[model samples]
Target: MIKVAFVFGFRNENWLGGINYYRNLISAIKSLPDRKIDPVILIGTRGSEDLLRDFPQLEVVKTTLLDRRHPSWFFRKLLYRISGRDIVFEKFLIKNGVSVLSHHHPLGKRARVPVMGWIPDFQHKHLPELFSEIELKSRDKWYGEIASQCSRIIVSSDHARKDLEKYFQVEARRISVLKFVVDYPKDLDLLDRAALEEKFSFEGGYFHLPNQFWQHKNHEIVVDALKILKDKGQKVVVLATGNTVDYRKKDHFNWLCKKIEEAGVADGFRILGVVSYGDLVSLMVHSAAVINPSRFEGWSTTVEEAKTLDKPVILSRIEVHQEQAPKNALYFDPKNASELADCISKALLCDTRGKGGGFPLNDLAVSNNFAQRIAFANEFQEAVLAAAYPQEKVHSPML
Candidate 1:
C-alpha cells in the first residue's frame, strides 16, 4: 500500500473547520474500495485525543516534531535554514516509510519524498485590507514556495486553481482540483429535533447561519436582512452559531453585536457562539434552511454539510458557491440584504423536515451520495499517486 502522511496540529477552536476538513478527507480516504493508499496522521504530543479517536482505522504517530512549542521544531527550522532542506523531518518521514506528504506546508526543494501542498483559498489576496502587511507578505512568500517546491499542489475548487495560476503563475499541469465530499454522522436520523430546538431556545422555525464571525463572512448583511424582515412585521428568527473569535479582527464579534442592537433586530437573531459539533449539525438539520452569506469561500463546509443532508441552502452568489451547485439551493447577491430577506421570506413557507426532524434521503439520493464519496476518494488517491509517481500518466479530475 502507498502510505501518505498528513500532519495534524490544529488544536485551536478557531480552526474547527480545518480540523473537520482533515477528518472528512481522511474518512473518505478510508472508504476507498481497493484500499491501495494507507493514510497516516503524524500528530504532535499535544494533539487532541478526540481527534485521534476519529481516525481509529489509520496509523497515528505522535511526535514532538509537529509541536510548535517543542524545541525539536526549532531545530528543524534551523536545519532547514542551514542546509536548504528539512533534513530532520525528511529523515523522520523516510524512516516512517511515508511515500507522500499531503495538505501540509512545503518541506524543501531538496527533500526526498514527494509533497502535495494544499492551498485552500486566496482569501488574503482577495481581502487584503483584513490582513497586516507582514501577514500578506508571509502568505505570498509561503504560497510561492509551495508552488515552486512541491511536486503537486491540491486546491479545493476550480476558482482557487484559477486564482493560484493568475496570481502565483503556477502551471495548471502540476495542480489538482479535489472537491471534497462530506460524510455525515450516521446518528443524524437519531437526533431529537424538538429536544435540540428546545435546548437551544428556538421558539419556532429558524434559519441557520453557521459561518464563523470572520469579517469576510459578511454577517452584517444577514443582520441587515433580519432588520428588514422585522420591520415588515415578519416573525423571522435566525440562529447563528460559530467561533466568535477572529484573531485578525478581534472586535468583529463585538461589532456584530453592536450592529444587531443598533438595527433593532436583536430579537430576531440568536447568536449562539462556538457550539459543539453535534449541536452544530443538529441545528443545521433542524433549521428551516441553512444560510451562508460569506463574501468569499474556498469550498464552504457549511454548504457541503447542507448538501449532504439534502437541506435547502440560501447561499451568496459567489463563484465557488456556483461551482458547488447544491441541488436544493437559493442564490443571492452577497452584498444585497433585501435579496437575502426575500429568499428568507420564501424559505419560511417550505417544510423541509420529515419525521424525527431530519431530512430523510431517498434511495437514489443515498446511492448518489455514496457514489460521490467514492469519486472523492478516487480523485484524492489519483492526486497522491501523481505526486508520488509524476512519470505515470494519471488523468487529472475535471475542474
Candidate 2:
C-alpha cells in the first residue's frame, strides 16, 4: 500500500477553508474503493487537534518539527542553512516510513523524501494592492521554492495551473489540476430548519456568503449591493458567516459593518460571524441562494458547497469563479454594486423549488459527488506514488 503523509499546517485561527480542504481530501481518500493507499495526517506543534478529533477514521501521527510555526522551527532553519539537513524532520519521516509529503508550504532542501506541493492560488500576482510588501516578498520566495523543489505540484483549478506557469514559470507537467469537491452532510433533512433560523436570528430569503472577512473576499461589494437594493425600496437580507478577523487589515470587518450602517441597510445585512458547520449548512438550506463576491478565488468552498446542495449562487465574474461555479450562476462585476443588487433583487423574488427549509436530502447527489471525489483521490495517489518512486510503474486498481 502507498503511504502518503498529509501534513496539517493550519490551526483554528486560520481560515476554515484550509482546514476543510484537508478534511474533504482525507474523506475522499478513505472512501476510495481500491484500498491500495494508506493516508495519515501528520500533526505539528501548531497542529489541528480538531482535525484529528473530527476524523477519527484516519491514523494521526504527531511530529516535533513538522510545523513552520513551531517554537524550534527557527533552530531547524538555522541548522538547515549550516548543515544542509533538516535532520529531525528527515529522521521523523524515515522512522514513520512516510513515502511522500503532501503539503502546501515549501519543503526544505534537505528533505530527501518526495513532495507533493499544494498551491491554492497565485492571488498575490493578480491582486498586488491587497497584499503588503512583506506579504508579496514572502509569497514570491515560497512559490519560487515550491516550483523548483517539489516533485509534483497540486492546484485546485486550471486557472491556478495557468497562473503558476505564467508567474512562477513552473512546468505544466509538474502541476496537477484537481477540481475540489465538497462532502455535504448526508442527512441534511434531519436538521431542524426553523430552530436553526431562530437560533441564528435569520429571516426569510436571506442570501448566504460563508467566507472569512479577508480583504480579497470583497465584503464591501455585498454591502454596496444591499445599499442599492434598499434605496429602491426593496428589502433583501444577507447572512454572512465565517472568521471575521483580517490580520492584514484589522478594521476590515468593523469598517464593513460601518459601511452597511451608513448605507441604512444594517438591519438587512446580518454579520453572524463564524457560525458552526451545522448552522452554516442550515443557513444554506434555508437561504434563497448562496453568494460569493470575492475579487479573486483559488476554488471557493462556498460555491462547492452550494453545488453539492444543488443550490444557486450569485458569484463574481472572476475567471476562477466562472470556472469553479456552475454555468447558471448569476454573475456580476465585482466593482459594480448595481449589477449584484439586480441579481439579489431577482433572487429574493424567485422560488428555490423546494430548496429552502424542508429541502429533502439527495442521496444520489451525495453518492455521485463522493464517487467523483474518490476518483480524484485515486489520481492524487497515483501522482504521489509516481513522485515518491520514479523507478516503479505504480498502478492503482481504480486506474
Best candidate, TM-score: 1
lDDT of each residue in 253-337, candidate 1, tens digit only? 9999999999998888889998777788878877888999999999999999888878889999999999999998999999999
lDDT of model 2, residue 48 = 59
RMSD from true fold, candidate 2: 2.3
CA lDDT, every prediction? Answer: 0.86, 0.79
Candidate 2: count the clashes.
1
For lDDT, the strongest prediction is 1
Q: Residue-wise lDDT of candidate 2 within 1-399, one digit each (tens)?
A: 768888776767457898778777777777778666688888775675864444537778876676775667777777777876566666677789878878645456647787888889988899999889999999998888888888889989999999888888888767878777877544333357668667876655678889999999999999999888888888878889989899999998888888888988888888889866777877887778889999999999889888877777899999988887574489999999999998987776674543353462477766778777878788777777778787888767773
Off by over 4 Å in 1: 187-190, 352-357, 394-399
Q: Taking the candidates one at a time, how many backbone clashes does each contain? A: 0, 1
Q: How accurate is candidate 2 locally (lDDT)?
A: 0.79
- lDDT for 231 (candidate 2): 80
Each candidate's TM vs. the true structure? 0.95, 0.93
CA lDDT of 35 in candidate 1? Answer: 62
* lDDT, model 2, position 365: 66
